[model samples]
Target: MSRFGDPEWGRRRGGRLTPPEGLGVLTALIGKQLRARLGSPAAPPARPDLDLALPDSRLVQDALDHCAAECAPDIVAHSIRCYAWGVLLADLRDIRFDREALATAALLHDIELGRTERRDRFACLCFACAGAEGARIFLEARAASPDRVTRVCDAIARHLNPDVPLKPYAESHLLNAAAALDVVGAGARALDPADRARVLATWPRGDFRRTMQAAMRREQAAAPNTRAGLLMQLGFGGLIARAPFGDTL
Candidate 1:
């Protein structure tokens, strides 16, 4: 089995955080905010490499169609915006990555999250791992290449990390950064203001905060032992509520 398929192995570190890392997340986000305000390039610009639109490919379109059909409008918008931010961050950071893989990972990282009403879907595993498995089955049914499938699923599995390393996991790193920025304002400053505006204007934030907060709370209630559940226990909702964009959205 691929290492990613091993839930125990994945939980060992990627999703499970060291206490220091867990504690450092809020501090790091505040630091990023302060640096951006004080005229420091704390991270790369989330400026798009292309116009803000879906990549012209059958696979991406299929993923979007599936996501939209299954997810809430807010969740669908969040996933699309994640794709926009992921590509933009990748280009600005000079990271060599597969665009399609990044987009697929971004759009489906929260696949298992759609039907949170059925909490049993992820009662025993991290939502990220469950999402990754769901994404894999969906992609394989569409005959996505093995390497692409592996990378996309691996990225979904890892996006819950406080920080994903860019070396061997560029796509994962970008997806995590974008997802975090949308949810907790992790790299809010790195994204160019104008570009960020464009993405949000196109996708619309809707009731994302409430939707995602509910999802997180449900996950925490169902799997308190998982990293996400543990983090939610550590006041993760407050962090999401306090994101810089929260005021406007």
Candidate 2:
């Protein structure tokens, strides 16, 4: 297995398209493209939270340390950058959310990615559910409150769902937006360009395109009926290639 933990990860797979399972994702994605292309506001949204760092609680540090140890280096960096991007998106919309939940969820969202082992339920599970369960176990072991544990796991589980509502699921909604921005540059223009540049400079992408592409394929292969598979059917490789970020910052 590669350091990424999958042997097939080096090979290209999705040679034939499966026509999306339905038109809902397609419609949502098209709407996303249009929204991303829309004109920027005359003035940027006021977001003092953009200056704040990731939550400093012990739970947050535990999450960062565990994720860094469990996942690939670039994947960990991507997760941290996901937190920053999600924070920016939350501030852009003035979404009231728990920073601790958001921070822990963002950092742990992809911790179970690239699992083709099928050696256990977690490895065999769908993309989002697997990671969410892993997070659930981690938080539960630490005696996290039931509500906080639910919040983090739910956010991680729904991070791949592009159309998650913002009213009560701000954590999930922001995570999805952040992941899309980092992976495909889908909504990069929604935030201030300077802040975007800063986020990248801090946690620069490093061969992320290659690793993330391979990871997505690993998930699709492990669970072809999942949203991961749906993303591939929707031309995910093309999206990754088209992302604005290069192999480095």
Candidate 3:
């Protein structure tokens, strides 16, 4: 029935996969709307408040796909995937979250790469800036209420900087978890067991990569008959879906 495309059209004829009771449905609706606005050429380069009036999941998915298609390092792609998963996990865990804020921030958390001129720092800056840009978009979209938007924007901006310790923000844990997913899900060239072990050794308390891997392992254990766990299945699937026609792996 959607004009853009039917995300769940194949699920079952005329059967809408019902949104979980309350806030879960609300978050999904808002996410869908934001996704649509992101794809609109006329949409300003700012994040929009969850208008609540216009919640459309297909739109949000499109915007995310557009962002993911802008082409960068595999690490960046992995981060976006993790960011998406983190938002989903936070929701599934019933964490009190600003889903729109988190989704926008996660999608653009590494957008700065588009502005970076340095080859070495390009990826790092891109990753951070994209998130910052997502936050910026969210903040700018709701210029009417600068206070709240700025707070979320600030969190997205500093999430990855080891120099910028996540001390005061309430969303630090979510952001850290997102960062870890990005690192762990990065291409084989970027991370392997050895590299992951070293980082996990350094940060023993709460390592995102370690956590994602552990979570992934548990999921796989639960569904041993499946080809791959859901997170990997989705992350790798996203990567493949975004790859160019002639691209390999």
Q: Candidate 3 — which residues are off by over 4 angstroms?
A: 1-80, 88-94, 118-138, 141-144, 162-169, 185-249
lDDT of each: 0.74, 0.75, 0.39
Once model 1 is optimally superposed onto the true structure by TM-score, how far is the C-alpha of residue 195 displaced, in angstroms? 1.0
Q: Tens digit of lDDT per residue, candidate 3, span 68-150?
A: 66534443444444444444334434456555555555555544332323323311222243344454554565452564464
Candidate 3 residue 58 Cα shift, in angstroms, is 9.7
lDDT-wise, the better of 2 and 3 is 2
Better candidate number, 1 or 2, judged by TM-score: 2
lDDT of 1 by residue, 1-249 (tens): 334223344545434445665567556546655865677475544454566577789999999988888788888889998988887777667788888898888888887773545545442367787787778789999999998987897788878766677756678788888998889877667767877788878887888988888988887876666667766876889988887774334
Ordering by lDDT = 2, 1, 3
Q: What is the descending TM-score order?
A: 2, 1, 3
What digit string (tens of lDDT, one per residue) describes model 2 on residues 26-120? Answer: 78778877876786564375454456478889999999999989889999999999999888887777788888889999899888788657426
Stretches off by above 4 angstroms in model 2 are 1-22, 39-49
TM-score (C-alpha, index-matched) for candidate 1? 0.82
Candidate 1 has its poorest 10 consecutive residues by lDDT at 1-10
